[model samples]
Target: MQEISYPEKIDPRLHIYPSQEADRLKSRLLEHHETGILDAIGRELFTRMDTAGLVPIFVLRGGLALKDAYVEAAGFGPAGVIVPWRARHTEDPTVSYASLPVVPGARYALVDTLIASGRTIIACLQALRVRVPGARVDVVAPFLATAGRERVIADAADTHIHCVWHAEDVDGDGRMVGPGFDVGDLVLGWQGRHLVWSGERGERA
Candidate 1:
């Protein structure tokens, strides 16, 4: 079993929970086709996050793969106010689709499978600022790259970021290196193809 490691000193606002299951899942992500394991890991992560009083409100398109698990672990109903968001471009991400509800002063948790470049999450934060001003947002993910962590902290200093696993950095293609692949694409059935939305609303360019 490969041991999980972390930096000597991590950001105070960033929370990382090392899990043996997550370690196994990371390896499985490279070879497995089924998402049941991913769902299981997501459930555990969300369940742990529930203790922090985080409420599920917004989820990115790739995060839909773990929606069911989050809903179950967080004890939220299927009809909960979890809005789906899409961010385009890594250089300067822009929200393409997100029906954010106006909830000033409300604290929200934004969900995503992984944070590689941090551009997508940054864009989501920008959109939330416009649609739901004065809202406090905490980002949740199963895995996070070191570069992404630094970028998000620098860009959104007030945001609290949580992750179950950590990667040393991102690869040239902007995928987490420890895992060496895109978790979102693998679980969402878009492996080896460009990452795009593929849910009830269908794939968007």
Candidate 2:
């Protein structure tokens, strides 16, 4: 990774959560994806979206936590629920039904707390393949783990992963351009930088 760097300012909303809150959230979302740092990263993401006519689409299971956070950040009236069910630890999505209720003809954004291994995204694609069909997919997350980022490309394949910022590393091995604040595996390395999902190739459906 590159040298460490911090932005002129870290978003204010992220600071709203007390250090204890981050610890508690970290424990809950440990196996649940990336809720710990999502709060920290969500501020940058919310700023990008502007919440102007924005509806949220959480990928169920994995995205449930993110959806909850997004709603808390943006509110329920501004954001609606649409969950896509897909297996996380298993390869079979049929076991859980891969679909979410999209209000149909409504503009929405997909939010996930983290993209750790991109398995969430792969499973998400399987579910969305039938439910959403031809809709545009916008992904949001806090930290895109070093190992997880590789799969993000394959998972995104042909869509955009619009997040606040993607960290180069969070393992504390000192590889990330910036170090994530100590919050277990969850941390905010940097803010206000984005990378295009070049994996979005052709005929994702």
Candidate 3:
């Protein structure tokens, strides 16, 4: 539970809770297998959001676990679409799925577990923009890297970004600092690529 200082030019659209509070909640989430604590965190985030007529858009794999908690906490139904994305050293980041027709100028909450380099989220945003011009998007996650936050803010200045904790830049070893674990793998049980299961015979084309 540490205090995080922000620069004078920090974007007004970026919202985050205190690290101490986030740490407490995150620990409970891990201990309880991401059930109650996830809902609690979601409630905290959704209460601050203007959720009326909002559409929830979950990113696949990593975001799958968050869907139920987020929807229940927000008092909404299931997401209409899940965007499958991949961002790895072996391939350029991409959003592989096309969503159902989007409503122009509608509000969307793009849910993901973590934002490390922001490449995946950025790629998702690009696809969303193409489908729903002038749509208002809010990038929601539990943990986010400082660099990733900055990158999203720079790329989508009007988008609102919300997270429980802010992590330091990715380390040289490619570890995300604050969370201290691979959230995707932890939530999903096993992971290779988002599109491919660990024990699968081969990656999907």
Every candidate's lDDT: 0.66, 0.46, 0.66
In candidate 3, what are the lDDT values of residues 150-171, reduced to their tens digit? 8899999678887766655676
What local lDDT does model 3 show for residue 127?
80
Between prediction 1 and prediction 2, the one with superior lDDT is: 1
Model 3, global lDDT:
0.66
How do all models score by TM-score? 0.77, 0.51, 0.76
User: In what order do the candidates fall by lDDT, top score first?
Assistant: 1, 3, 2
For residue 37, give model 3's deviation from the true position in Å.
4.1
Output the number of the TM-score-best candidate.
Answer: 1
- Give lDDT tens digits, candidate 1, residues 1-205: 1246343347788887767777777677556645787787787688767434455654545577677888787665322233333443334555656654444345677787778878777878877777766778888887777778888889887798878765556767565665544555666576665635635444545
Tell me which of candidates 2 and 3 scores higher on lDDT.
3
Worst 10 residues of 2 by lDDT: 196-205
Task: Show model 3 residue runs off by greater than 4 Å.
Answer: 1-9, 19-21, 28-39, 173-175, 178-180, 191-205
lDDT of 2 by residue, 1-205 (tens): 2122122232222211123333443444444545445554455456545565566666544455455456666776544334333222243223143333456564456566655545555656555656667765555655445555556555555555554334445343322333333222232332334232213221211
Tell me the lDDT of model 1 at 191: 65
- Write down the worst ten-residue block by lDDT for model 1: 77-86
lDDT of residue 55 for candidate 3: 76
* Global fold similarity of model 3 (TM-score): 0.76
Candidate 1 TM-score, true structure as reference: 0.77
